[model samples]
Target: MKTLSLFIAVCIASTCYSQLKKLPIKKTADLHAFFHYTGKGERIISGHRGSYLKGYPENAIETFAYVLKNTPAFFEIDPRLTKDSVIVLLHDATLDRTTTGKGKLSDYTWEEVKQLRLKDRDGNITPYRIPTLQEAIDWARGKTVLNLDKKDVPMQMIADLLRKNKADHFMMVTVHNAKQAKFYFNDNPERMMSAFVKTEDALKEYEAAGIPWKNMIAYIGSENKPANKVMFDLLHARGVMCMISAAPVYDKLATVQERAAAYRDIFAQGADILESDLPVEVAEAMKQKH
Candidate 1:
């Protein structure tokens, strides 16, 4: 019985290690080139909320690490602050939905939040606990890029964390408009930032920001497929890559094949990045012929 138990333990440990594995991205250069429009039409994928499937809890380190290990994709995670002013990965203002805790996320101290287990998208409680921003940043070092969506934390705090971890190049912050992009660019000129450019006016706005185009990724929102070829061309002219988020349109499709075609269409429209909830599926689709 003792030997059997030891064998079981070993198997479990191996499985856990397999789940937390890293990808083949040896350095940040490959990821940087893919996002910065320098990779010669390399199509990139941003795993929405870190592939929050059945076993993978959203915004959890395990999910992010698993995606990094399995797929050639970066991830987007939401950052919130605790009552004690600690930055943590959480989507909503309250933890009642994603965690076992009650009330506002800010109501709990970091210690209290750490005790709460994360829930999968289907609402099943997982064994993972909330990870601090610094913990996530540390784990992403030289492995994968992270798009840090500014949810509840201040921009300055986020910038400081990126600088402290020396993760500016590997991580990104999403900016809604050119003004916000300018603000973040002014604060830390070297950091990577993503902004939306839906029209010619939007392009003008970004150009007016006075920041270098190399440091930004333009998110061109599309319907079922990528539109606005002129905007894409304009951005590419200035050495900027545009991302098309397929989550809003293609995620609701009934089959993977349909979604795959949609992704291919987006790329055909000159989108450099593909954002999706099904990162693994999309990455697989990208490899296959449309």
Candidate 2:
């Protein structure tokens, strides 16, 4: 009996060691380097709604998983509250467009929300269903980062959830202005935030608001060309990455050549990140330029 017990203990120890070896450990400095401007201008990609047009359901964990596996990109997922106050991944106020159900998302309880199947970008019902915010957070651990786009939920509530899950390191919350940035920075200075910094004046405003520049990715909102060279230079100088969103606008550019040209110009202007509906395409374009 003693020999048998020893053998079992050895087997369990080996199994545990093997499992630990399989886990991917992301360094904090590396994650910061990926999202911050280092003057070298390393490019990053964010999948808008998790590559929804590539047959994956928008805002679904499966879609995000597919993106991380296929491309070196992070995912932007929208989180909204259900009737029971559970936060879940969703892009619209109503579930009619993305799901089989026809009602306001907040009107449905989580149990009911889980039953509705998600539709593709083309409106075809897929096997995926709405995932809870916690579910997405769990999936992102050691895999990729998630950019939380503000929907109906309060930023404080979202921050609380991130703290609960110990996921603040692997996610960033969207902030529209300096005031929002200051609000979040005051809560936890370590939290990452994405906000618009369209001009040199915007940078000055952020400084005056006491926003943490090290924990920010400035979204220089420009249609085609980069927002402003001075703005880009200032952000980079302060070690803040400049993100150019190519969605619902530049993504709809007339032709493939035009879109490609626009992306090239964005990089040439020293933009560190590209948030795109066409994440895979943008990644490929970046690769070709390199």
Candidate 3:
């Protein structure tokens, strides 16, 4: 009996370690360096909404872990405020779609929110509960990066959360424009951002704001186009990596083969990173190239 128990414990520990792919980032500079463009065809995969799988719920820590188990990828998560002012990982203002609970997320306090279980994309209820942003941050430290997308939460509050946890090394914020980027930059000079620079005018806006290019990775657009080549060249010249989000476009394709082809084409067209809802599939598609 004793030998069996010891064997089970060892297996559990090994399984946990194998599931996590560590980023090895300990400081802000390390995070920046990881995202810096090197012109060596470095392709990265980012999980959009934590890579919602059949059994895993979107924006749940469990889903994030499942993706990391299959591939080395970071996550783009949404943060929203509760009625009692606690920050939580949720993609929508309403909980009906992603949780067992109904009504607005802000209508419930953290205590009430924690009681509800998460639902997968197919509406199948899972045992996983909603995770606090702080809980997710704690889990991501040294394990993976969490890119917080702009939601209903105020920018100052998000910045304060980062300051409170001292999580500048692994946390990144999504900024829609130069002003938002500048705000985070001024708060912490080492802060890394995923900025929207899909156009030449937007590129000029960041240049005018005077934020260092080393501090950002530009999101060129949803689809790969002839125009993206121009932005890729321009941003790559500044040592900033370029990303393309396929969540809106190719992830909705009719078949797995079609999505896989789209994933391959994105990198073939000069995108440094591809953000997708099916990160595991994306990893599988690009396995040979990497």
Best by TM-score: 3
Candidate 2 deviant stretches above 4 angstroms: 1-28, 254-258
Better of 2 and 3 by lDDT: 3
Q: What's the TM-score of each model vs. the native?
A: 0.88, 0.86, 0.95
The clash count of every prediction, one per candidate, is 0, 0, 0
Q: Is candidate 1 or candidate 3 better by TM-score?
A: 3
Clashing pairs in 1: none
Give candidate 2's whole-model lDDT. 0.79
- Candidate 1 residue lDDT tens string, 95-138: 98888999999999998998899999799999999898888888
For residues 42-116, write the lDDT of model 2, one tens digit per residue.
887888877767477888876765566557778788999999999999999999999999989989999999899
User: RMSDs, each prediction?
Assistant: 3.1, 6.3, 2.0
Best candidate, lDDT? 3
Off by over 4 Å in 1: 1-32
> What are the Cα lDDT values of the candidates?
0.79, 0.79, 0.92
Tell me the tens digit of each residue's lDDT in model 3 across 1-290.
99999988986644475558777688887998899999988989999999887899999888888888888899999999999999999998999999999999999999999999999989999988999999999888888999999999999999999999999899999999999999999998889999999999999999999999999999988988878899999999999999999999899999988999899999999999999999999999997553
